[model samples]
Target: MGAARVTRRGFLLGGAALLALPGTALAATAPEIADCAAWGARPNSRVVNVVVQRPVKILVHHTATPNVTDLSRGAADALARGIQNFHMDRRGWLDSGQHFTISRGGFVLEGRHRSLEALRNGRKQVEGAHCTGQNLVSIGIENEGTYMDTEPTGVLWDRLREMCAYICGQYGIAPTEIYGHRDFKDTLCPGDVLYGMLPRLRGEVGGMLGQRLEGSSVRAASWPVLREDDRGPVVEAAQRLLRGAGRTEVAVDGTFSAAMAESVRVFQAEHATEEVNGIIGGESWPLLAAPVQAGDGGEAAEAVETLAATSSTRPPSRVGPEQWQQLLTAAR
Candidate 1:
């Protein structure tokens, strides 16, 4: 099959350029997707307390269960209801745990009503509870069926790819931005088989956006001097960017490790224009940084501005000095 082509302008609009047969293939803004009305409305829905002062970075998730079934709009609605119940009744969340839900039949349902609203306006708002601290910058998406028992269906793959491309384009997130839930937490939420598609998924999304591979999103940013307090901000930023860049293997715990080192190596090798010494040196640091550039013709610049302002005004309450040191050492 021929590769998909995505335009930078289209990416900025959160649109995807998908290729494939009409029935089997789908694009991000595909009209086939049912509206919120398709899925029953949340009874007594109330606004949540959490404040999202920024846009989303990565889309995290799970398989929900191993119950694979035929793709249908009804099945998708059922999954949405189940999700609403689980999040509200069990998790004590105001709404569903994810921003979107993909049924076995490839039906995509919006979880939080405001989620789509946020995406549409281009304002960076937090989605739902996928990762703990990182949830502030990530959007959680749950896919039906455990890929372990059976491979994801063509519908699911096509839909997921389209959605990923859409989200990436909308937020100026490179294909490297999409991720599995396990990438941040210490759990197998997305399952092994599905997680395995992470790399290729990112590449496919990038292809749709017409962007070359940006390589691993994780790893340490190179800094010549590691001040005691520098680790927290720098490492957290790197972890977030790596996930957004589609290097979903690293944890955002602020601890740099061998895996991070490996990611740095891979990123450098892929870029070719940089040194592949596994160091987040000054030269490599800027490239690894997200929000692209201040004046670049991309959404990355706007995101960078948002992140800088947010981080400066409010420090991440979770990261610690020890974690920062580990991250600094690993990147070096």
Candidate 2:
């Protein structure tokens, strides 16, 4: 099919129906997604605000459930309701954690209440609960299936690429910003099989949108020693960690500025001794990147434990190694 055109009138309406052209064919703009109500979702009990800024990345997740073969719309709708019920009733979340759900049959349904409206506007994002530290700045898309053992169906994969391309074009996001959920979290979400497909997915999205593909979101096993004046996503990640750790002065923007240097110095002073320089070296990255479990004796973990021991009152007496690990991970 040809590229779908958007009329000025349609753009002004700002309705979910304006997401596509008058036919069932996919569009260059946002895909024709079924809203939560259309999928028989119950109304959210509380109010939700769309984040004023566009999301910096798109996080992909797999439902981690059985790969259901029923490809009917009713099945897809039921899947959406079940996920919403689980997230709300069991997980105690306000609504669905993900912003969108892609069915094995290629159906795309808005997961959260306001997610479709936000996407139609193309200037804001609905905050998601999919990733802990990334909830505010990342868009979450959950594909329905377990991908650890098998790959997604061809229909599901094609629709995902098209939806991602449309989202990227609308938000001015780079194709490289697409990432598996495990990139930022500790769990193996989006699974081994689907996560392996991210590169090809990114490439196809870039090709479709005629945009250049940049770097992937996966962090190297070992990060370079970052100091003042260093700048990039790594620095941004550090900044986010600092902010989460209660260093509110540091901005999470990608640039490593003077404020960031001071924040890093404060964190170093509180978490590690010996050297209080604002540099993030082998001693700091692990503590800031992810939780350090027991038997996880790296240089960074040792430094963290040592610092925790020195604290006179904070971290509470009841806090154990696992709790400490959680505190540090959330900070990162």
Best by TM-score: 2
What is the TM-score (0 to 1) of candidate 1?
0.56
Task: Tell how far residue 244 is off in model 2, in angstroms.
Answer: 23
What overall lDDT goes with each candidate model? 0.57, 0.70
Query: Worst 10-residue stretch by lDDT in candidate 2?
Result: 15-24
TM-score for each model: 0.56, 0.62
Give me the runs in candidate 1 sitting further than 4 Å from their true place. 1-32, 49-56, 214-332
C-alpha RMSD between model 2 and the true structure: 14.2
Model 2 quality (TM-score): 0.62
